[model samples]
Target chain A: DTAVSQTPKYLVTQMGNDKSIKCEQNLGHDTMYWYKQDSKKFLKIMFSYNNKELIINETVPNRFSPKSPDKAHLNLHINSLELGDSAVYFCASSHSFGQRAYEQYFGPGTRLTVT
Target chain B: TQLLEQSPQFLSIQEGENLTVYCNSSSVFSSLQWYRQEPGEGPVLLVTVVTGGEVKKLKRLTFQFGDARKDSSLHITAAQPGDTGLYLCAGLKGSNYKLTFGKGTLLTVNP
Candidate 1:
């Protein structure tokens, strides 16, 4: 079974358009995260939610918002998509927070292209 | 902000060759993790090291955590074409579950 899965694996939209990427994990994890991998392949964490509570919010722009309806799902919504928003978005989940050996499971990733 | 820096951003070698990738950071961490990502896919965890000066082996791959918990290394013996991918190292600080990831080292094993 796919432990972590993401929908809309490929999203292509024009500038100023809005888009959303859905993510779900069956690992029964308490924490879920959203990451962005730019063209240079630098992966950076944008947001993290623990049991549907926002825990970490990096210095990302307000245009990007992450919503977790429950502990099993986390979704990212982008407003006024720009060319710089074109990158791969990955969803990840972990069992809990503050564990020394916490391992995160990642989804297949969604490639977003903002034209 | 804590940052992990991986050395030799890119490596290209022939099959059967051995290589070692380094992940270094100035800030100490409670744990370190190594991941391998293939093209068009998300990264998959290879191993996690929690103790200082700890070493773990998975077949031909060996992972070592630094004594100070600020660095780590991954050694692959007799690499095959399947080993070609992007290798990333992530560190976790005390009480912070967020991971600080390195830029990653891209390894290309040619047959």
Candidate 2:
């Protein structure tokens, strides 16, 4: 069984379009995160949630928002996506927050292409 | 902002060779972790070093944390083709739970 799974492994949409990436994990973890890897391959943390509560919010633009309805799910929704939004988005989960969390288990990344 | 910096962004080595990847940061961290990611796949945890000057060994991989808690390194011995992947270092600084990652070191082991 896959530990962490993401939907729409590949996404191609036009500029100004809206898209969403869904992530789920069955490891019974409480903390989940969203990271973006740009063309330069720099992985930046965008958001993090612990048991459906928002914890970290990086300096991401307002167009991107993350929602966690439950402990097992964290969804990313991007509105009015622009060409600059073309990058790979990843979802990750851990058992807890901070040092208490053993390690992060990542899901297959979603490659988004905005043309 | 706390950030981790990885050296030798790209590495290409022959099988049975040895290599080392370094991760440094300007800020001190309470704990540091190393992760390996394959193409088109998510990263997997390789090791985590918490104490300053701590060294951990896993099979052919050796990880060490700097005494100042501001740097770490991963040394692989007799690297095989299976060892080719992107190695990333993440740091958890004092009072901060978020992981600040480095750009990563991409290793290509040629047979």
Candidate 3:
């Protein structure tokens, strides 16, 4: 079983379109995260939710919002996507937050292309 | 902002050779982790070092944490083609739940 899974492995959409990427983890983890990997392969944390509570929010624009209906699911929604939004989005989960955060398990990334 | 800097952004080496990748930071960390990522897949955890001057080994891979907890290193011995991937280092400072990642080092092992 895939511990972490993401939908829409590849997404190609036009500029100014709205898109959503869904992520689910069966690891029974308490914390879930959304990360963006740019063309340079630099990974940055965008948002993190601990047990459905927002715990970390980076400098990401308001166009991007993350929703966690429960502890097992975290979804990312991008509105008015721009060309610069082209990158790989990865979902991750960990057993718990804080000190145990390093042992995160990541899902296969979703490649988003904004034309 | 806490940042982790990785040296030698790209490396190409032959099989059976040895190589080292370093991750440095100016701020102290409570723990540091090393992850390896292959194409079309997310990163996998290789090792996590939490103490100063601590070393951990996983088969042919050796990881070291700096005494000051501000840096870490990954050394591979007799690297094989299977070892080729992007190596990333992430650090957790204080009680932060997020990890600050470094720009990864892409290693290409030629046979």
Candidate 4:
């Protein structure tokens, strides 16, 4: 079984179009995160949630918003997307505190291309 | 902002060879982690080094954390073609609950 999963493995949309990506985890972890991997392969943390509460927001633009309805699910919504939004989005999960708290499990990334 | 810089942004080596990739930072990290990512997939954790000067080995892979806790390294011995992937180093500082990642080192192991 997949520990962490994402929908719409590949997305192609036009500029100015809004889109949303969904992520879910079954690892029974309390912390979840959203990351963006650019063309240069630099992975950056965009947001994190612990027990469904927002924990970290890395100065991302207002267009990108993350919502966690429950600890197991975290979704990302982008408004008025632009060309710069094209990148691979990844979802990850981990325990809040413990020996393995620092270890994260990531899902197969969703590649979004805005043209 | 805390940043981790990885050396030799790209490396191509042949099987049965040895290679080492370094991860350095100006700020100290409470813990450091190394992850390997394959094409079209998210990174997989290879090792995590928390204590200074700690060394952990995974089969043919060896990971070390600098005594200053500001750097780390991953060494692979007799690398195989299956070892090719993008290696990433991430650092967690204090109690921020976030990781600062380096650009990454892309390794291509040719048979």
Candidate 5:
């Protein structure tokens, strides 16, 4: 079974348009994260949710928002997408309290292209 | 902010060759992890080291944690084409769930 999965694996939109990417994990982890990988392949954290509670919000622009409806789902919504938003978005999950709490499982990334 | 810098951003070698990827940081970490990512997919965890001066071996791969817990390295022996992937090193600080990941070393193994 695919432990972590993301929907809309490829998203192509024009500038000023809005889009959303959905992510789901069956690993039963308490924490879920959203990451952005730029063209230079630098991966940076965007947001993190623990049991549907916002825990970490990096200095990302307000145009990007992350919502977790439950422990298994986390979604990212982008408003007024710009060319700089063209990159890959990845979803990850991990336990919040345990010996292996730091170990994260990532899903197939969603490639976003903002024209 | 804690940062992990990886050297030799990219490396291409023939099969049966060995290589080493280094990840260094000025800040100490409570735990360090290494991950491998292939094209069109997310990264997959390869191993985690918690203790300083610890070493773990996975088949032909050897991972070592610096004695000061501020750095780590991954060495592959007789690398094969299957070993071609982007290697990432991540560090976790005390009580912080956030993982600081390195820029990654891209390895390409040719047959």
Candidate 6:
């Protein structure tokens, strides 16, 4: 079984469509994060949820939202997707928050293409 | 400028060669992490160096953290085809506890 897994590895939709990417971790983690990797291969943090509390919210657009159903799952929903949303979205989970905590485990990544 | 900048944006070498990837930053960090990502997959954490000037080794890989905790480096010995991937370094930054990632160095090892 995968320690971290994401659904619909590839998502393709129109610019104005709405979509959601689901993520889950079996590593018994307390924190989950979403990262966006653009075509340039620059990985940036988009959102982070620690114990169901919103922790890190980068300068991401308001159209994007993260919902953590519990400690093991973090889902990202995008409204009114734009062409700029075409990037690989990654899901990661960490055992804890501090530096000494276990390293983060990343999912296979979901590539979203908005045309 | 990136909070953490990785040099040589791209690297290509022959098998059994040696290479080093660097990640630099002006701001200090509590810890630095290195990840290796393959195509169509997310990054996999290779190592994390916490103490400044600390050096850790895993197999043929060596990781070093700067004395100032603002930078780090990854060195691979006898690089193999399996060693090729996107190398990224990140530091825990800001009050947000978010990772400041470098642009990443894509490595390709030729046969």
The docking quality of candidate 6, as DockQ, is 0.77
Across all candidates, the chain A TM-score values are 0.95, 0.95, 0.95, 0.98, 0.98, 0.95
Measured by C-alpha RMSD in angstroms, how accurate is candidate 2?
Answer: 1.5
TM-score, B chain alone, candidates in order: 0.97, 0.96, 0.97, 0.97, 0.97, 0.96
lDDT of 4 at B33: 92
DockQ of 3: 0.87
Residue clash pairs of candidate 2 = none
Assess every candidate by TM-score.
Answer: 0.97, 0.96, 0.97, 0.98, 0.98, 0.96
Residue A24 in candidate 2 has what lDDT? 96
lDDT for position B1 in model 5: 54
Best by DockQ: 4
Model 4: colliding residue pairs: none
Q: Please give the distance, in angstroms, between residue A103's alpha carbon in candidate 3 and its true position after superposition.
A: 1.5
B58, model 3: CA deviation in Å? Answer: 0.3
Worst 10 residues of 5 chain B by lDDT: B1-10
CAPRI tier for the interface of model 6:
medium
Model 4 chain A weakest lDDT span, ten residues long: A95-104
Give the alpha carbon lDDT tens digit for every residue of B7-110 in model 6.
98999999999999999989999889999999989999999998999999999999999999988999999999999899999887534557788999999999
Candidate 2 stretches with Cα past 4 Å from truth are: A97-102
Which model is ahead, 1 or 6, in terms of lDDT?
1
lDDT (C-alpha, whole model) for all candidates = 0.93, 0.91, 0.94, 0.95, 0.95, 0.91
Tell me the tens digit of each residue's lDDT in model 6 across A1-115: 8999999899999999999999999988898999999999999889999999998898999999999989999999999999999999999998665554646789999999999
Evaluated against the true structure, the overall lDDT of model 3 is 0.94
